[model samples]
Target: MIDGSPLVPHIWFNQSVHFRKGSIMVLKTLQASRVLVVAYPGAADNEAYRKVIGNLEGRTVQEETCKTATQGEVLRMREKYEHSPPDLILGIGGGQVMDSAKMLRVLLENPGKSFANILEGPLAQRSIAYVAVPTTPSTGSEANGTAVIKGSDGVKVPYVTRLMVPDVAILDPSFLSTFSSDQIFTFMGDTFGHAYETMVSKLTNPLIQSIARSIIDLLKLASAELRQTPADARGLDKLMQAGYLGGLATGSVFVGVCHALAHSLEQQKGVAHSSAVLSLTPRCLSWHAETTKDPIYSHLLSEFESIGLQSRVSPDVLAGVDLLLLARQALADPAMKTSPIRMKEQEMMGLINWILKK
Candidate 1:
């Protein structure tokens, strides 16, 4: 057991595993003979990925790129490899790539089942092992069993199964250097929003709350440092750790209104997930403060201020959003059921108006 606990999965941090020799040793340990690599389009050409792939000597490796974690895309991948499934699946990139890998494992295990059917029912035990190597510091998909994939009906669908969690998660800060300053901030926004939502959710227990608070503190420190030096490896590592903790908290207690709204915006409007979270989280916090009288919001506001983030939504960030539609769509999300206070249509509209205020 790592860190004296058997509950947490094995995780390697700030490791020099991107090198050829290290990669070979890691793959050998996993006994990976036939390996399938699912990565983002840009990641296909990344030097880090290239080095790792090159080191997989004497192994049969197949590579696929996923632009989005949609049901259709996952189904296609399943069809392609139906006759001969890989012994191991490695997800290399950000949340979408990782989520694609997690979902693909399910599809491969249960052939001919629709994504909806699989989500609604219990999954068969996963046959293959998945290893997640995140290129970004957001989402922490590598550490959790939840995958949020876009559905065939153009809705964001979340699939959770203990079987979907990766067998291994690798964190390397070198990949973070690829992101620009704006991209870094957008990802940081996601991390912050996730921590906030997890902390304020009604399902939060004492253990979950402690983990959530630690995630927030780490996010605050990492983001503050990144604002000045976007390429700081130590800061990036901190962000990755915080994101991992956020993922644990989310998987443990689940998220609330902010994620519900963000998922809806991403599905309906085709907005980027991080952008949606950045635009909506502050407004969700305000709504909670007004209706629930939760002390978590005030504490979150202070943390946001400390990290140079505004405590309210920025209108410019969501200039063209249709508030009414967003509110209605968000209500359908399962996340709403766990909100600290019940959200009626009137309260939902109020949250929308709060987001729109200049």
Candidate 2:
């Protein structure tokens, strides 16, 4: 265990047993054999997914594959096509696909309504059973309940709340085998961010602390294996599991600056979510140290050293380099909120200047 506890996040790990083993637990959960599988066209073209799709055959099912779907389109699919609130909405891609299912389920639950209303104010609605099957690891859509909806003007708007966590999320290690580490990796930054941010949050508790430690420890082990041998399946599995743990922690406490910067850029500037997050994380970590170093920096330093990043970046330089990276993220980010740490605008600009090197 990284920090000797599972309390950082609340997850039904037992769901994995049922998902992988094809156990009857699924049957018990779904009274109706009918299922709705949603994926982007890209996933539909994937040969690797054929078997899973085939298994769901012979039942009442509706498959939707599209480039993009608006909230209105999702609602119309349900009301017009009579595809009522599905017994289960299975999302088979990254965040966009996952958000589609969540919105679909939400619309179905409240007939004649759509995300427009949900965005207008607080939602009285709760979660309907949505199962998220992640093809890529970084988005963590399976673990969180917030969604970004593109408005009529082609701008994304966010609806943040706790109602977005999927009822079930299935992470298959085999999926990682198909990905080139250089193509798209769930970086170890989340391992540190989730733990450190949660620790720094006013809501930190003994349970959250325990979960954070476990994720950090596991991430260190996984990162080490990847460093030694990039294609290690055993190593990939640990990395995937660590990502899962980070998701659980982030969903509970929510990420701090690294993610906040990503959100600002993606929503306001239309930056690609993965690229935006990857770009901003280091800076936030640097600024974070200036603001918080107690148990937070202590824990972060230990995790980074364990993963072999600390030696490359001495403790003396971590804050400087990380801040430089994060500042570029903010400048490129179309938006951001002043964190609880209260870094001034001038200070933030200074940090940005450091990140935007020639």
Question: TM-score winner among the candidates?
Answer: 1
lDDT score for candidate 2 against the true structure: 0.57
- lDDT tens digits, residue span 1-358, model 1: 1222213423222222232112323655567799999999977567778766876778899999998888888889999998999988989888888999999987898886677587655556657878888887778788777898887787767777677788777766667777887777777778888788777677766777787788888877887788778777667888877877777777756778888888777766777878778767767776667777868787786776676666433466556767778788889897886667688888888877777773
lDDT of 2 by residue, 226-343 (tens): 8778867666666656666666665555555555555555544555555555455555565556555655565565555566544332122222234544455544432233133545
Query: Cα miss at 87, model 1 (Å)?
Result: 0.6
Model 1 global lDDT (CA atoms, 0 to 1): 0.75
For model 1, the stretches where C-alpha displacement exceeds 4 angstroms are 1-25, 119-122, 311-313
lDDT of the candidates, in the order given: 0.75, 0.57
Spell out the clash pairs found in candidate 1: none
TM-score of each: 0.88, 0.74
